[model samples]
Target chain A: MTRKREFTNWIFGRELRDSRELEERPDEERAKPYVITPLGTRVRRVLFCGLVSQKNADESMTRVTVTDGTGNFYISAFNSDFGMQAKAMVDALEINDQVLVMGRVSSYQNEGKTYFNVNPEIAIKVDSVSMDYWRMKTLHIARRKIYAIRMARNRPGSTATDVKAAGYSDLEAESAMKAMEKYPDYDLQEFESAIAAQIQPAAKEEHKSSKDFILQYIQANDTDGRGCRYEDLLAASQNASISQNELDDLLNSLGSDGEIFEVSLKRYKVI
Target chain B: MSDQVKRLKISELVPGTQNVDILVSIVSLQRKELKNERGESVYYYGILGDDTGTISFTAWIFPPTVRIGDVVEIKKASVREYKGINRVYIDAGSEVIMHPGESMDVRRSYSQLKIKDLSTAQPYVTVEGRVSSVREKELERDGKKTMMYYGDLDDDTGKIRISSFDKPLKEGSFIRMEGAKVSEYNGRLRMTLGSRTEVTEIKPSFQVGERLYDIHDISSPLGGVTVNGFIVSLGPKSGLVMRCSACNNRLDDIHCPDHPEAPVAYDLFAYFTLDDGTGSIQCTGGKAALLGHLGFTPEEYTPENKTISRRLVSSRLQEKLLGRAVVIEGDVTRNQSGTSVRISSLNYVDTDFMKKLEARMGADFQ
Candidate 1:
C-alpha cells in the first residue's frame, strides 16, 4: 500500500543505543531491528528535529550531525538505498539549518565502545513552526511512552494488546513490551525526570523553586539551632508551591544527605 | 473481578454442547407456528451475536421481556449442527432471563459496529459507511408515482443499498446513519431511511492504505480502497470555471442559456492524472478539496477578490502537487476509458498539511 511508517517521537540523542550487540548476536530466528536505550526504549524509528551542526559526505555516503536541546544525533544517508536523498543532503542542505528527520537507528563498534547513529528515510528542511511542532509532538509521545512502560512493568501478565486497549497506541504498546523484555529491573525515576523536564520546562522550574523554599524555610525557622517542630514546618512548607507529599520527600532526602538532623521526635535541625 | 466461569461467546458454542451459558445480544427473532408432534407449536428462531461471532438459535419457549439489543444470559442450552453451521437451541425446559444491569456500553458498541454485521432481522442498527453512488429512481405504487433516492453504502466489510425516501445525500460522502430500517432484497440486506432515521456526515477515523492496488487490476467500481501514486499530469478541467448563478450549471460565457440575464459565480477545480508505475488514473476534487490541495484559504482567492488569476492558481497547483508521491482515497468508477476517482481526501505524504489535517481530524495514524 506504499504505507510509510510514521514515527512521532523526538528522543534525546543521549538516550540512544548502539545496535551493534543485537547485530552481533547469532540467532536463526528473525528479529525485528530496534535499538535499546539505557531507559529500556526500543527505537524502531524516531522523529528527530534539530539544527544541522556538521555535514560530511564521501562519494556515495553523506553523514550529518544534528544538535538538539540535550545532545546531538548522528544522521547518515547511504548511496545504494538512499542515493537521491544522500545527494540532496550533501548538495542542498547547509549547516545551522533546522531539519526534521525520521530514521531508523544504526550503530558501529569503535575499539571497545559503541556509538549510535541514524539512517534517515525521510528528511526535510523545515521552518520554525514545523520544527517546534515536531518537538512538542515528540515530547508528548516520549512522555506517554515513559508512563506506559512503567504501567506495563507493574502489570506483568498484561500483553501489548492489553496495554493498547488501556488507551495506549499500538506503537507505544509494542515499545513498552520491548522495553520490558530487553531491560530487567529497570529504574525509571531518572527517565521520568528527563521526560518531565522536556515536556514542560515551566513545571520543572516551579518544582525547583519549591525545593529551594523547603531548605530556606527549615533554616530560618530552626531557632537556637535546635531544629524545627514537624507541625510548624508543615505549616510553613504548606505556604510554598509544592504539595505536602513532595515536601515530605524533600525533607527525607535532606536528612539523608546530612543537610538536616532530628533534634527530637517530629523535629528537624539543619546540619 | 472474581474467580468465576466467564460468559461464553457465541463463537465458542459448538455441536454436542450441554449445560452451556453465554451472554449474547439478540440480533433477530421471529415467531413461527408449526404442527408436528405437538398439534400446533409456536417457537422463536433467530440469530444471536456477540463481539466474537454470530450464531443462529431456536428457542422453544420465548420470553416476553427478551427483545432485540438486549444483552441476555441464556441457561441450559445445547448446541446442534445445522447445515454445516452451529445453532444453539434452548428447549422449553430452559430459562430465558432478562438479566438486569447488563448491556454493552453504548459508545463502545457503536464504534465497533460494521455493515457486515447487519441483518434483516435487526429492528434498528447504526453504521458508518461511505456513499459509493447516489441515483434517483421513479416508481408507481398503488396508482401513485413516487421519487426515491438510492445510495450504495460501503464499509470495509461489505456493501449495502440505502433507500432514502426524502433525504438527499451526496454521491461521495462518509456518514454515520442511525435507526435505518433493515430489509432484505434479492437475498442481500438493504436499509431504508424513513421518518425515524438520522444521518450525520463524518470524516474517516482510520487509515485506508492496506493494499496499494495496481490501477490496472481494478476492473469494476471499487470503494473505500487506498492507492499511492504520483501526480503525473494535470487535466484540462484543472483550473477555474464560471457557474450560472441561477441554474448552478457550467457557463461557457457570462450568460447561461437557461437564464439569459442571470449572474455568474466563480469556482475552482483541480483534477490530475496519477501514475503509480503500474498504471494511471484521473483524480478529481471539488472546490474545497481543490483549495486544500493547493494549500490556499478560500477567503484569499474568492470570486470577490480577483487578485489571483485562474491561470496562476492552475499553475501553482501543478507546480506544488505534480510529480510528488501522494496517497488518495475514494471510489474508482470504471467505464470505457478505465477508472477515475472522486477524491474524498488526498495527501502528499511528507508535507506539513498531513500533520495539520490528521491532528485536527483526530485520525489514528502510525
Candidate 2:
C-alpha cells in the first residue's frame, strides 16, 4: 500500500510542547517518526504561525525560536537537500518577523525529558490577517478536541462509536478515547484555563508606549550609520518589561506605518 | 434452536465465522435471477444494518414478506470473506424470523451535508433539497430496461445535479434523501441515487439563494459559487492566444489544422492564483472574463497589429490584477492535479476587507 501524506496538524505551541509519547513507524529507514500529544493527537507534521524571537544562522545550520502568544516553538533547518528551502526562508527573516511555517516534527530526549523541534519544509512571512486566521482555526480545532475529551470523560464506559454518534469526527473520537486511556491523571482544568485566558483583550495602551520607546531608541542609537541592532532593541525593551511578542507586533506596526525599515537581517533603521 | 447460535452485531461479522446469528434491519434489497446447474434460481442480496454498523448479506432463501426497513433476525448464518469484504450468507440451515412488534434503528455513517459540501472523497451523503428541472429517459443495459431521472436539487446553500435510477422524483417537490452516492464527472459533482437510497417528501421550509463561500470550506467541485480573494500569482501561459475561428479550438500555429481555410481569432486567456487568507485556489479565465478588465477590444486586438505582442498583454494583466482584491463568481473544479476555479464573472471589491474583518472577528478576542 502506498503511504498517505501525513497530516500536518494545525496546533499551538503550548499543545505541541506538551507532547510526551513518541511512536516509531515500522519502517525504520523510510517512515517518518511521530509523537502523541497529551491530547492523543499523533503529530508528524505541524502548521503554525508565530513571531521570530531568536535566530542563530551559520554555514551548516540555522536555528530560530518562534513564539506564538502562548508558548515558544524551536525550529532548526540544516544545509542538507531536505532542509535547503527552509534554511533559505529563515535566512531572509529578521528578528520580530511574523511568519507561517509548515514542517515535520523532530524530537530528542535529554535528562529524562523529551524536547520537540520542527524540521521545517516551508516557511513564509505572513501578514497580520493570516496570523489571526491561523489563531482562529487552531482555537476552533482545539476546542472541538477538548469537547470530545470531556464528553468521553463524562461517559467513562463509552466507546468511539458513542462519541461518533454525538457528532464528533472519527479522528476526534479516536483521539479522545486514546487520551482517556493514556492520560487519566492529566489536568483538564489547566488546558481550559489557558484557552479561556486567550480570549482576554490585548493591552492597547501599554502597546502604544512600547512602540514609542522602541522608535525613540532606534532614532537615537544609529551611531555608525548601520542603525540599531535587533539585539540591542530586544535588551532595551526587556528592561522596560516588554515581551518579545509585543516587540514583534510593534516593529511590524512601525514598518506598516513607514516609521522604520530593516537595513539588513537583525538590523533596523528609523525612516 | 436459538441457544446454540452465537448472536453478534453487524460490525462483528468477521470472516470465517460460523453459526453467526444477527438481528438487523434491511436497509436495501435487490433480487437476482440466475440459471445454475440446478435450474433457474432467485436470490436476495442487499445491505443490512443495526445501531452498530452495516454489512452486505446474500440469501438463497429469503423471507417473502421482508422489505426494506423491516427488522429480521437471522439464525445459523455463515460469514465468509469474498473479494476482500466480509459478507453474511444464509443457506439451507439458516432461519430468518420476523418479529412484528420490534423495530431496529439502522446505522447511518454518512453525514447530512449541503450541496456545497459534497465531495468525491465522501462516498455517501444525506441531503435535503427541492427537486427541479427534472428530465426522464429510458435506459437499457445488459438486455434490461430501466427509467433514469436526471435533475437539479437546490437548498439554501447551492445546487447540484441528482441522477436517480428507476426511482422518479416529482418536479418542484421538496425531499430529504439519504445514502446517495457522490461521484464526479466532467469537473462537476453528481449525486447517484439507487436502491440503497431512501427518499422522503418533506414540506419546504427555506428559500434557495446564491451562496458565497470561504476558500477553505470549498473542498469539492461546485457550480455557480462566489468567493472574495486577492490575485496572488499569475500563470506563465496567461496572455494573448490564437484560436480557430470556425471551431474556437486553441491554435498554436498561425492557422488551425482542423480548419486551415478558416480565419484565426485572437483571444485573451488569463490564469492566476487567488488567496483569501483562509485558503487559496488557482483560477483560469478567458476573453469574456478578462477582455473588458484588460482594456482590450476585439477590433483592436486583431492579428493586423504588428507592434502588439504577447509580452504587452502579459504585462498589462499583471499591472491590473496582481495583488488586487476582487469578488469572483465561478465554477470550482477538481481533477487529479488539484482544485481550481473557472471564472464566469469577476469584479473588483471596493470595501476595505480588513476593516470588515476587524469588525466581525474583533468582538470574540476582545
Candidate 3:
C-alpha cells in the first residue's frame, strides 16, 4: 500500500480567505482540510508570530487573536487533541506578549458568511529576536510561494495535469489550477506590499541596548543633585540614533520599575 | 504592410472565439508534410503560452513562423472545443509574428529551501536552522591543515551535518545563511560556506532557549533542545561522580577506562526520570546547574564543623529537583525505555516575564 500524501504547509499574508467551500480529491477518502486563497494556495499548516491582541479560554475551548504588522490571525484550540495545550497557553499567556503560533487550517460559517481560522497546535512566547526572525523568514517563504504561483501560470498547458507533468508536485499544481479558476485577474499588489514592508530582516533591532542606553543617558545628565529634564533626555537619545517612541516606552518601563522616578513634571532621576 | 495586433492572454482562450488575437510563447513546434486527396504539405502543430495559460494550435498548409519559447502574437485565430478543453486552431490567413523584446523568463524553485530538503542539484541555496554543534576540523594538505568547522544543523523537519571551510559557527545558535553551496559528502549533502555566502544569526520564531515537547515530539535522537517536566526518580549513580582530570570523562569506581593513570576530580550529577504527563524520559543535570537555579550550592547541603556531605546530599537533592517543574536543555538520546535527555543547562522556569504584565498595569510596579 502507498502512503498518503502530506498536506502542503502554507505561507500566510495579510489577505483574508474563507471560501465556504470544502474540496477533496475523490481518490483520497481521508479528509485533509484546507482553504483556497485568491493567490491559489491551499493552506494546511502555518506558522506565524505576532503580539497577543486578545486571549480567552475555558475548560473546553481557547481562542486567541495575534496581530503582526500586516494583519491579525484568529486561533481556536478546541478540547480535542489540542485542548490541554491550548488551556496551558491561555491560562499562562498574557496580553501584549509576543507569541509564535504554529497550527493547522480551520474554517467556520456564520450568517451565510465564511470565516477562516487557525487551530493552534503550538503557541509559545517569543522574544524580540525571534519575532524579527519570524518576519524575515516568513517574508522569504511568501515570496517563493508567490513566485511558484506565477511560474505555474507561465508554464505551457497551464492546467493541473500540465503543471504536474512540468515537475511541480500535485499539491502545487492543484492549487495553481484552483487559484486561477477561483480568482480570475486578481491583483497581487496588496500582498506584495505587505511582504515588502515586513521583509527587511526585521531591521536588526539593537533593542537589547535600547533600554540600557536610556538609563545610562539619564544617569549621565543628572548632576548637581538635579534630575534630568525630559528635553535633555530626548535630545541625547535622538543624538544616539534612538527613536522617540522607543525612548518613551523605555522611560515609562523604567519609571514603573522604580529604577527611575519623576522628581518633577517631565524630569526624572535614578532612584 | 504591418498593423497593430490585438492581445489576449493564452489562459483566456476558449471555444467559440473568432478572429481573436492572443499573446503566447511557442513552447513547442512540429512541422509535418501531410498528403490530402491531392497530396498536400502542411505546418502541422505547436503549443503556445504566456504567463496566464497555454493552448495548442495547428496550421495546415501554412509555413511554420513561430519558434519554440518565442513570445508571439497570433492574429485572427479561432478557438474550438477539443478533448473537453479549449484549443485554438490557427488556420491559413492567420499570422503568427514574434512579439519583439519580450523575455521567456522562468523561475527555478530552489530559493529559501530548508536544510533537510537540501540536495546537490542546488549549488547555491538559502536555509535556516539551529546550530546544534560546531567541531572545528583541520583540513590537511601537504603537511598543512587549514581549519574547517562541521556539525549538526537541525530544524523542525530533521537534522543534517553542515560544514564550512571558511566560516566559524557556535553551538546552539539559530542562524540563516544565503549563497551557501551544497556538495555531496560521504553520501549526504553538506553545505559549504565560501566567501560569497552570508551567515547571520537569526532569531527563531519559537523560544530560542525553551523548547518544551511532550512524549510525542521525541522519537529518535535529537540535537540540543529543552524539555519541561517533573523529575520522577533518580539512579544509584546519580550524585558524587568522579571524572578523569586529563579528559573530563566520567570515571568509574576504580579509574577512567581510557585514562587509567590520570588523576580524578569529583563533581555532582543528578540522573533521574522526568515525566510531563504525556510520557517520561531519563534526564541528567550537574550539581551546579541544578543548585544554581535552586538558589544554593552543595555547601548548604554539608553539615557544620566539617561534617560528612555524602549521604545528606541525596535526600536534599531530591527535595531541590524531584517532582519540581523545571526546564532542562540537553541532547535527547533514545533507548529501549524511550528518550532521555543529557542535560546541558537546567533552570527553574522563572516568572520574570510576569513583571512585563504588572509593569504595564501600573506605574509603580515595585
Candidate 4:
C-alpha cells in the first residue's frame, strides 16, 4: 500500500481516548507494552494529536517537536533526502498550533535517556479541517482555469496581468503567485504546473514542455566549466519564439531525461 | 643530436648555465624572503638541493606544495648569481614538473657534505650551519608570531650566521640545514640558508662541539677564544608578554580569563645589559632567554623590592660590561641604541691566550 494510504487507514482505526487518561498512566508502564509486544502482535498504527512545540533547522534537516500533553516527540525531515515532502511539512507548520501526525513508533536512546521517535508519514493542519475538505474537492476545476491563464501569461511577449484579465479568480491566481515566489526562476507555465502537480498529481501528464525546455537549455549552456544558472534559462525562454504550452511540455520532458538537476528552488543546472 | 640524451644529476650541472633541465632528489628545503626595488615584498622563496648542489627557487606564482624529500624534475630552469653567489632560479615562463615516485641516480651535493671536506674548499664554499640564535619577533604585518634566528657553524675553516625563517620553527628541537648559498653580511662574509635545507639529527658521529664556532672570529683566522664576564643589566626591550585583563595573570592567550571576547594585552619591550670588559650592549627578547639559561628569573626585578628601576637596570648593566675582557661567541647586530651581541655559547678564557697576547705586546704593556 502507498504510505499515505496506510497512514490514513491507521488514523481511521486507532482507539481514541481523552488526553487526561493517557497522561495519568505511569511512564514505565506506558512504554513497556509497546516495546515487549512481539512483532506478530497486531502492530498498532496510530495518529498523534498534538500541539506544535518547537521547530529547528540545521544544515539540511528540519525537525519539528510536538507535545500531545501525554508526551512530546520529534518529527524530523532531511530536506536533502526528501525535498518536496520536507518542504511541504515546513510550510504547513505554525508554532502552538494543533496538528495530526500519522506514523510508526520507534524507541531511541540519546545521552542515556530513552524516548520514542516518530517517522511521520502524513501530517495535516487540524484547524483547516472542514474548510480544507471542500477546498480539495473543488480545487481541480478552479486550478485548471488558473493554469490556462498562467500559460497565456508565459507566452514570449505576454504580461502577467494579461493572464489575470483572462478570468482567473484571485485565490486561484494567488496560488500561482505563491508558486512563483517559491520558484523565482520558473516561467509562469512551469510555476503553474509544479503547483498543479502538488494539488492534482494527474496534471503532471498534462503539461510536459516546461520541463523539456529547461533540460535542453541546461544542456546547451553547461558546456562551459561553470554550471548553467536558473535565471539565465528563464530569461532565455522569455526571449524564445516558443508558445507557452510548448515551453511547459519541454520542461517536464527534461526533468524525466535527467540532463538537468534542480540545485535549489527554481535553480536548475546541468547534471 | 640524440633525442634520448642522458639526464644530468643536479650536482653535475655547471654553475653557469642557461635553460638547464635536471632530475634531482630534494636533500633540504629552506624558506627565504626577498624584497623588490620598490620595497614591496615580492616572493617567499625556498632553496631545493640535491647531493650534487643546491639551487634557489622562487614560490611567487604558487604556494609551495612540495615537501623536503620529494623528487621533482626542474625543466627549462636557469642558474644565475644572486648578490654574488651562484644560485638557481626557475624561469617564470618555464614549466616545472614534479614526479612523486620516480627514482633517479643519486649523487651527493657539496652542501650535503660534513665539516671535514668543507674547510679545504679554496675561497667560497656552501655549507649548512646549526641554529645558534632563534628569537621570536612580533611585527605588525599579519599579526602573527615571526621567528628570526641566527645559525652558527664551522665549515671546518670558519663560522657564520645564516638569517632564516620569519615563522617560528615550532617542531623538532634540532634544526636540519641545507642549501646555504654563501653571501656577505655587513663587512664579514656569511651564508643564507633556504627552505630546502635538510634538518635531521640522525647522522652518525654528530658532535655539537666539533661544529660550533664564533661567527665573527671565524673569518679572522683566529682559532678558539672564550670569555667570562658579569651581567651588568639584562631584559628584552622588544620582548613579548601576554596578560589577561580580568585577573592580570600572565597567559598563553588560550586560557585568558575573559576568553572569547576577553581583552588581552601583549607587551614587546624588555632588555638586559651585559659587560665582559671589552664591550657591552643591550640584549632583548629571545636574547634574554640566554640570561635565564645563566640563572636569572623574571621575578628578580619585580616592583615590590624596587632595588632596580627597569631603565636603570638596562643602562647600568650596559655600562658595567663596557670594557671587561671576556670570551664570547655568536652573532652580533649593530643597531641604533648600540651594538647588540647575542652570545650563543660561552666559557671563561684560560690564561694561555692572554699570556700569548701579553708576550706579543712586549715590555710596552708592562
Best by DockQ: 2
Docking class of 4: incorrect
Interface RMSD of 3: 13.5
Candidate 2: tens digits of C-alpha lDDT, residues B119-193: 654446788999999999999978899999999898877778899989998999999999898778888888989
Candidate 1 per-residue lDDT over residues B126-214, each given as its tens digit: 77888867998887867998778898887765466788876887788988888676776443457788776778999976432233454
Against the reference, the lDDT scores of all candidates come to 0.64, 0.77, 0.62, 0.44
iRMSD (Å), candidate 2: 6.6
Q: Predictions ranked by lDDT, top down?
A: 2, 1, 3, 4
Clashes of 3: 1
Instruction: Rank all candidate structures by their TM-score, best first, as comma-separated numbers.
Output: 2, 1, 3, 4
* Highest lDDT model number: 2
- Model 1's CAPRI class is incorrect
Tens digits of lDDT, candidate 2, A1-271: 3343355577777687677787789966876577887777778877777778789999999998776655567899899987786799778777778777777888888877788889886666766555555665576567667878898999879899998889777777888887888777667677654543332234223335777768866764563468766765674465345787999999999999999999989789999
- Candidate 4 per-residue C-alpha lDDT over A1-271 given as tens digits, one digit per residue, 9 for 90 to 100: 2122121111111011101011122554654223211001112234444557677776676677664322244677565554555446654677666565655555555565444545555555554321122223223323343364455446644444654565543333443444343333434343333333323325434536545445555654442335654444543343233444665566566657776656666556766
Clashing pairs in 1: A1-B212
- For all predictions in the order shown, the interface RMSD in Å is 10.6, 6.6, 13.5, 48.1
Better of 2 and 4 by TM-score: 2
